[model samples]
Target: MESSLKIGSAQLGPISLAESRYDVVKRLLALLYKAHSFGVKFIVFPELALTTFFPRYWMTNQVDVDRYFETKMPNEVTQPLFDAAKKLGIGFYLGFAELSEEDNRIRRFNTSILVGPDGKIIGKYRKIHLPGHSEKRDDVPFQHLEKRYFEVGNLGFGTWPVFGTRVGMAICNDRRWPETYRVMALRGARVVVLGFNTPTENINHDEPLHLRMFHHRLVMQAAAYQNGMWIVATAKAGYEDGFHLHGGSCIISPTGEIVSQSTTEDDEVIVYDCNLKLGDYILNSVFNFKKHRRIEHYGPITSQTGVDDLIDVSSKL
Candidate 1:
């Protein structure tokens, strides 16, 4: 396995409604070239990278919403990116809206793909943790309608061998959940790559604006350390059509340290040389699943999804 691999987080700026797919591909290509110059072997782009965060807008017409979803990857609009990566000998992870025909029905998903240096797709992940509500809310400044547009991902969390190391994929809200990383880590994933488009404001409750970015880093850092894996997170940030998304694109080491982070909420690339073995000490000492994990005692994690009523011991007390 390759001990050291350089990765890049390509954080994109706003992609307006007027911007064409061809335009977005051009921006992606520029970042690809920039990372190549820095000797980055792989790069990660943000969720819904091709278009504006359309889920925030309430659209009654299915036709209007379908335009944001891609029927097939590497079609005419995205082939250039594939071709460029092949020529440059770079691999990438990209998140987008996927429209697929499965189980004799058409379905949509918030999805991401891991592409090898040879331009072949290695693995795919759909966002299982679809956040926000399906119903429209006119009271808030905007809506987060992921539940309305996409079905929960059918493909479970998976890991794939990439650049001589095992890597996994996640998207947006999946980062906030511990189960997402644990599943992949159990499968021997040495690194996890993810992309997100998070609004600066929380529509669900009265939340402090600064906590948006704070929690973004908090979850990923904790997961990285606890799971003994590196994490590369990219964001579709800045104001898109006047809606603000925070950008704190970053790379975290297995030790839960921020190796590199983007300074702007715009189109920026941050690169880091990740040592796969950096987590060996952590895994062998504190987090060795084979030796230390006590699954027999952790029944509630998989057996239940939400909290159950606790047994009261008031009489004994």
Candidate 2:
């Protein structure tokens, strides 16, 4: 079952300023066709792939806000995308906003899914770390109201036996957190794939554009090396609704090297043949949890309710 899988990370330019989900799907279909041409078995699309980042603006009406969310996967506009993937016999990861009727009420979440080459749903992940403010920030030029639109994701990080390898899914902000990758790594995930839509400018604070790009690669690279897993990070980049997004979609190795990457901010696919077993050596040696890790001993932080007073380590030394 251990085999080389050709994986692609797509870097997409802005969705139309009008936020057309239909057009987005068309673009995805085009990307799928391109992926097929390259013999890519699996493709990773960016977060909020179905529409422009809608939370960037503030809206009061619930119906108006909910319009951006999909009531069901493979709906009228998106069924063709699923169909194309099936026809091409390629699997993929897609991130989108979800409006689900659960427990007799409508709930919204930032969601993503992993599909098999046969186009069947394999596993799903809801983004747990919802970024930005719930209330509209009028002071800033743009808004990030993810906390207003989405509830906390109920499903914890999960890994699945997929594509003859253990794979996991994460959404935009989730990639920034080390725990997101660590949880899946603990679950025997060989590959942790994620999709993101990150703007070039930080609205909350000032940061150089180049520094933002550096940080994006920095965190994922460290996560891959520390966890001994492959990482595929796809991005919805370039300008969306006047905001410029960073597009550095990449496929990373267990050794924390970027094996493949997107060169353009527009719709681009970068593919690499990933060897799933490459991480075993690191997992069994340096990061072998069962053999060397001692989690029970690190209780000072987990056991405390309030911040612990800083100790003078010099005295102990």
Candidate 3:
């Protein structure tokens, strides 16, 4: 299996704000069927995928809030999707809201998991860089309360060996940060799969809707080229609960080229036969880490805990 990976990204259309877990898995199964038809070995889905972007609606009732969180992965409602993937001999990466008991207390996280072709859960990554506010805003039409609902991720960035390539995972907002890709790249990841649910509007600032789409692709492309890894980024897009989400789910090559992308803001599958080893060529050339890296001088880049005026240490060079 030198270069036999047919990777796909599943871009989902809107799931209504009140869709059930059973219904959500049905859409996933449909995508799986489509991928099987295309001979896709692995597929990536969108973040907070099972239901509508519930965080957009602020809630006071605990039961209403907890309804969106899954107490366990592949509980009765989602088990069928895993079974279906195994039956079809396809692996997948899925994103969801996870509710688990840690230290005798229930904790919530925005999470994603990697499933092997055998339907076994391989690895899980909780989203570390949670986006959005922790409370409701009186001025905005809708809320983005990820920070209020989900705790910051606990597991750090990591990669796993499989199919002659190391794979890594990230969630929605994580892709915007360089460290997300670099951390995985440092671990020798040949391909990284991430899922996102981004609203078309920038509530924090007045920005054009087009920039939302551009910025999304820009970061992924930059990450792919800088790290010399394949990137599969999928989205839960379109109008979910009256808010339009960007749906430019795409697959980028090691060269930072858009190999495949979903044009429609709907449930679509885009596949790419990737020769992951192509990334090695870039890694060994201009981006050669061992030959070019100067880590000692980069400490200042990570020293601050919060946004502050940076020291002009680079001027000394």
Question: Against the true structure, whose TM-score is highest?
Answer: 1
Candidate scoring better on lDDT of 1 and 3: 1
Q: How does model 2 score by TM-score?
A: 0.94
Ranking the candidates on lDDT from highest down gives 1, 3, 2
**TM-score of model 3 relative to the true fold?**
0.96
Candidate 2, residues 1-317, lDDT tens digits: the string is: 57678988877889866757778888998998898899889999999898888888899999899888888887899888889898899999999899999999989999998988888888989999999999877789888899999998988999988788999999988888887888899898889999999988799899998899889998999999889889999999888767888998999999999988888899998999999888888988998889997888666644554566544459766
Q: List the residue pairs that clash in candidate 3.
A: none
Whole-model lDDT per candidate:
0.94, 0.88, 0.90
Top candidate when judged by lDDT against the true structure: 1
lDDT of 2 at 273: 94
Error of model 1, residue 72, in angstroms? 0.8
**Candidate 1 versus the native: TM-score?**
0.97
Give the distance in Å from residue 5's predicted Cα in candidate 1 to where it truly belongs. 0.2
lDDT of 1 by residue, 214-240 (tens): 889999999999999999999999999
Alpha carbon deviation, residue 195, candidate 1 (Å): 0.2
TM-scores, all candidates, are 0.97, 0.94, 0.96
Off by over 4 Å in 3: 306-309, 312-317
Question: lDDT (0-100) at residue 307 of candidate 3?
Answer: 58
